[model samples]
Target: MLKKRNFPAVDLIALEREACRRSLATFAQRAWHVLEPATPLRWGWALSAMCDHLQAVSRGEITRLLMNVPPGTMKSLLTGVIFPAWEWGPAGKPEKRFLSTAHMQTLAIRDNLKCRRLIQLEWFQSRWPVQLQDDNNAKLRFENTATGFREAMAFTSMTGARGDRVLLDDPLSAADGNSDAALLAAELAFLETLPTRINNDHSAIIVVMQRLHERDTSGLILSKGLPYTHLCLPMRFEPDRRCETNIGFRDPRIKDGELLFPERFPEAQVAELERTLGSYATAGQLQQRPVPRGGGLFKREWFGTIPALPVGCRFVRGWDLAATEDAEAAATAGVLMAQAPDGRFIVADVARAQLGPMGVERLMRATAEQDRAAHGAVRGSFPQDPGQAGKAQAQHLLRHVLTGFDYHFSPESGDKETRALPLAAQAEAGNVFLLEGPWNAQFLDEIALFPMGKWKDQVDAASRAFTELTTKRQASSSSGTLRGFF
Candidate 1:
């Protein structure tokens, strides 16, 4: 016979290679071993989600794809390295051209090298005939024997090049995300330049990144209602924010606050990450949102609501006034708060209005009268500006409007962020309580948006009230502290 050819063994080998070639996830698992045999693979649902979407792109099902996943999720390893190699070899699409760019050219080159190394492996070569051309095996650009090529470039260097598949991996660094010019440049490259670089109508573009800012490339695309299959996987599952993309793909997890990729990042690891990244970075990089999931500085869960004020509570009605009644102008706000016997802070009532100075004066006088009737012996706290006009305004209000009230005027010492610290600390420690009122929603909403909110009048008043309640008494000096100045 012809040397007794082992056809059964040959057929089994072909089947194994064909399975890897058909599924990106399967190929990745095998490729992971080839690339890093020391560390075992910890498979998760997120990997499956990404592979399914990428496979769709290869099959011409999704033309534009955007994936916003948490950092350290192996997004780069999967999309940048293995997907392209799998496509060229097992998928038998070696003629497909690829243009890959990142925030830095070095990162693009890093993945490009990984992909190049992957295709040349004996295991990969034993199954697929995809071989790199001897003429062009450089770092920035490389070509396969079948005429397909992978070109690595920086987001800033995307000039006169075209590709059938364009991939942008973290186009804006966290530091650069804060710069307007950097954001605009990255966005323009994605929106204006990259679209034109696609070789034909069948070309697909994929963007993978962790969100860094509200105006990041992903945010811009979503805001503009672009035709993209967006897959957002945050570190924790938020039931209300569960994403449903255009391709009828919905987040499968039903429970709120469920961990994503718990196999890789367990509960303890996530807690460590949250502690290490701080609130802001944890929110943006891990939670896939620019703002904290709880709140910026204040968490909504911190303030427990009480049916009524506790006994022996000393009260202060803090005011943050506006100069005009314009609809766009900040609303004049007054917050009445009390320091309880147990040293906790309790917010009682809020009076907010958009009015002129005279109207504000009337409202203030009426509110003071209401405070006197409801709560016994409540003191007033008003903010004084720096210049003579601010002093004059304070004197006018004290003499004419808030006559006979025990009040003091104090100029704000530092920035809004600094002033809000005392209240934020109390809120975080669960020492802040909200007395049941109709204004609870507005107060909590404004507090949650603190420093970042467009209108901070409510927060300013609340911070002042908390400060007034917590300030300690010092011995009187010659400078005469502005305490109860008649």
Candidate 2:
């Protein structure tokens, strides 16, 4: 009962040729398939754009390409592993030489092994028969029969290497990036030594790394205003900001806070990363903007200290919550401040701890009870962040934990810099006082660092307290409704 089943004839030769003509992205996908077949490759838009940019550089269409992507986004795999293999095999450019370096020799060698393993795959060798030359096969360097070679070196050993194409992957580690001397040495190596390693004027240079510091390789290269095709892919999309590749592929995410690769890392996971990295570090590594440490608007010496809390001063506790028990997550901060009759502000106490959601609620309740016992009637100020989720969180805290407490939920407006400016100005004028407390050192350090510090909960909570205290006291004084709290 079969109605003569007919299938199209398979064109094995034609299909093989077509496979050779596959784009770099497809080549990477297939290579991943061959290398790790069980684990399917998740091709996000960012990776596709990155592959296209790399392909342009390989084709001599672009001389310099600077790519910035968050860690664990397959940046090293795509750029250092798959691209080189694709260039030699399907692209038919086995004669091209590559010099790859990393901040550490182990990282460079790791990629070297991946590339060699990829080329040695039966699928890859059957498609493009580029045999490795005898006696030249090693972990750090290798050569093929076509005279093309790949040399993996540490960043410190780039003085004597030469190549037609140079790839620098994460030239500085997190610790090195934070050090002035280390960053200076890296900058010098990139500017003075790295360029000399190019074999010819037509040689291409590629740098792939997340932003680490203001003077890091990416920052230095960008500051020079050189002709570089920059491809920046942040973990989350920032509204009104877009990165365009030279081949005309633009970042596809149009919404703010949209994830770069939700299939691999969901929104919750990225948020956890942000919390663990803190705002300042995340701004650089994840958001591609390294804020300067000393360039913050607030200054350390501006903070003045008082001997003790003034009697009859109105008190309020401002809270900034993280709601995670993880030690790496941002800590929840509760700053207690008092407004004097003479319009001066004094920080009475600061309590900060990392806790889960339930733990945070308990801490808030206990802090409220303690403050009430000490200062009769203390008001609590909580920031109602933007969006419906923020509003719902505020409502939940009010209903579940803050019942019977005098509190005000103010909708936060403007950026952190803007909101902290008023307090910064007051502190700079020597009007704000820090009452002697155990939390003095930590609080001052965070406040002085302001927008640049890793943990900013203290700064946020203090700013909220200052704003609330000043505004409420001003309103009461103007309306002639000023009342005293025992």
Candidate 3:
């Protein structure tokens, strides 16, 4: 006699043989007539949403549907394989004009073949022989009762062909999104191709893909705008909901003390995602969060609590210059101010814009001189561009505009973000204060995201100036000099 199966659960250990199963024989692919394990309510809700989305497309209730979910949760299984089978009158009438693409042309062809295989199963051979307009190369066609003929193709070589319903499943493929441009380019080409291949404006485009990275096409789509229901099912979406595909509120798998998390995801694996990715990335790729750009590095919440600079602190300025207002570049300057007795610094400003090198020099001198007037005295700093010409220019500025002022040439190394993170952390944690003035708005906004690994000019200059002063002060005190030179 067969052993009794546990309610709301299955033995995944027995299913371990087919981690990436394609055949319709898997309980997930063929029928949901029985309560299958997965997020059943959510899965059903999503399917219901999908059908509404599809029907909306058929009647123009909506235009495009973008579905992104993490791996091992059957994105294509629901949207591509099973959804299409059900649409084709449930028992394989070979319905829907579905074009499921991966990053590669061949992968698109494979999905095309998978759908054909399901229809060709012995139980549904009436949908077999898949008809031959072009079988070997990835073009498929079938008859639908109301919609007439339907077709599917890989991204490559689909010129003037048309479709009544187009399902672009998993376009910017996760396999190639991270480390391959050619793969991403291929996917974009496919996406562009789908809209063009649509027979009319009445056609609907359904996109299903795994969320890969911040700059991937999925990221681009999510950044800009796309009309679709974005669904994310993490390992712990529900404990009592055994069927991850169900996703219902009353999920039988989710309970107060269920051990679903360990069974679904190892602690080590989840930890890696948390450590390696940013907050936006964690939400988008791992947690399947929508509109991720909304949660940028510097939220508006971090703005209001900015403190005022203390009195009697002299200021020195550091500038990393930019030459032009051309579309690609930004000019930058950093302001480093310090109090006397304690020798502690409070970074007061950042000025970034598009300006010429000479214009930047002039602006730096003016800003420094003006700041000094208020603080008794201050100095101006430069990157010591490592040339006789640059050194002479620095000496010339000290003599002319900055008479009776000090100037120092400093050089920078390593990454800007790396250097600035320690300083930025201090600022964010309320350890650093800014000189309260009109410039605060521009300064705070520019410094917020401060660029990644490259030497962000303004941030670099500020960090380098701090390093130089701190190093000199420590050296002087050790050598028993007059002051801890700030």
Candidate 4:
């Protein structure tokens, strides 16, 4: 026998109002009815996540935040429409100024109108003390009597205005992804312009968009290693890619390949999206990865992995050298590959890092020593650049750094794509295999993207190593002895 406990009508009303004021999610639910009376509320965890992170920003906990979500997840409605209004009314921050932008002016203005419409509703006005200015009628700009204003503009048109919060929603359209110049300009804008538009060090910048390319704004920020709290939620759950943020936020899904928001977008709908969007679009827009699944030119299924090295295999390590530890710069990569007895290629190990000239030499020498200790008679293949400086550098490594090692230096001929063709053919034919190690993911990702990927140091080293290994295999067949060079 259980009895139901009930509060007074007045008390219940007060409690509901207090809850709406305290939490952004509650406020968004209350505001959604006023904005979309015909549409039902299909609430999910993804919506709650955006609200939580946005509230954290409103509380001055996070200054820079980047969110990568799918296309139809109501990202704009939460960030562009509801966030500023809730902060002004419920959160008691009526004086907060906001600047919001999208790829086009029309898109920004559309969200601006929605926010203004929600704020002017009778129910909203009765509860919150927000008063709009009489002259605040422009689609691009609006103001409240409490000194809070929201301005809308294109991402390229961001200048001559500052705000307490900057919201960038879908800053680049996928239609323009084919133009490399356009992509570069968008990245440059984020790096050079957007930072200048913030009011102060305390101001917050929030970017919400689906990844469109490897060189998009999100990619640039991540590659440059800038300080931003990233919250990436793909359409499906990938256990290996479950993102954990600095704010103690992690994807709660435990199952692999589970739907992110099945309430709104069911499994069937997601399948249709994948089929229609194709692999490239689906990967960028839905999966939050710029590369296609199973890879681009180098298919993931084409290569296999082995647990241990095969017996009677000849080993060689290739070096693609670079100086300076810049995040945007190319890294020095070394690939240790083996030619098995049955004429198959095994990628035993890969080591890559951005370093100075001295650091590069140290790593080369260290890698040589390690390879020799593990696999006997592992030879080194170093690339020789054109001209006298290149010859001097190669001679220096052979004489000073690698004094006792068997090595050879040869000038690299042809472009990177052409040189990688032979390896790509072997990989396509299922002849290329990888030795099981911790380096598989990065190595495969780089190889998958191939010539189109941003960094090619690892692929270049692997290609050179494969060439060196095969060349020796052919030479030994004719000469009947393994030749050595120091």
Best by TM-score: 4
* Candidate 1: segments with Cα more than 4 A from true spot: 1-9, 177-181, 246-248, 299-486
Clashes of 2: 0
lDDT of 1 by residue, 1-486 (tens): 558666797797798788987899988987898888899899998998899899999999999999999988889989999899988987889999999999999999999999998889887888886878899999999998888999999987797679999999999998975576797788778777878879998999999999887678888788789988999999999988998876667888988889999999999999999999888778889988877977887879989999988889999999898868888568999999998999889999999999997899899989999999998798888788878888878777877777787666778888777898989898889998999999999899878756544467988898888887888633342221344335
- Model 2 Cα lDDT, one tens digit per residue, 1-486: 869765554465446546655688877776787777798787787888888888898878988999999888889999889888888998889998999999998999999999999999888887788899889999989999999999899986686669988999999998875576788789888988898999998899999999887678998888788788999888878865588766787898988878999878888988999899876678778888775233356766777888977777999898888888887458999999898888888989998999988888899889998999989889887776677787677777777777778765767677666788888888889888899988998887777655644567988898888887777443332222222221
Worst 10 residues of 4 by lDDT: 476-485
Error of 4 at 145 (Å): 1.0
Per-prediction RMSD in angstroms? Answer: 6.9, 16.8, 9.9, 8.0
Best by lDDT, which number?
A: 4
What C-alpha lDDT does candidate 4 achieve relative to the native structure? 0.87
RMSD of 1: 6.9
TM-score, candidate 2, is 0.62
Cα error of candidate 3 at position 141, Å = 11
What's the CA error at residue 75 for candidate 1, in Å?
Answer: 0.7
| Candidate 3 per-residue C-alpha lDDT over 1-486 given as tens digits, one digit per residue, 9 for 90 to 100 | 999977532345334223212233332333543223364422433344344344444445556666565554455656665555544533233434554545455555555556555555644333223443333333454444444344455554565556655666655544454444544465457556656877666666677666654445555566566544444344334343233222222223455433223444466766776578655455555555421333333332343433665566656666676668664444656666554344446666665556676776667667776766666566656664556775566555556645555555544556565666556555555455555667676555545534411124656667665555455533232222222123
What's the lDDT for residue 83 in model 2? Answer: 87
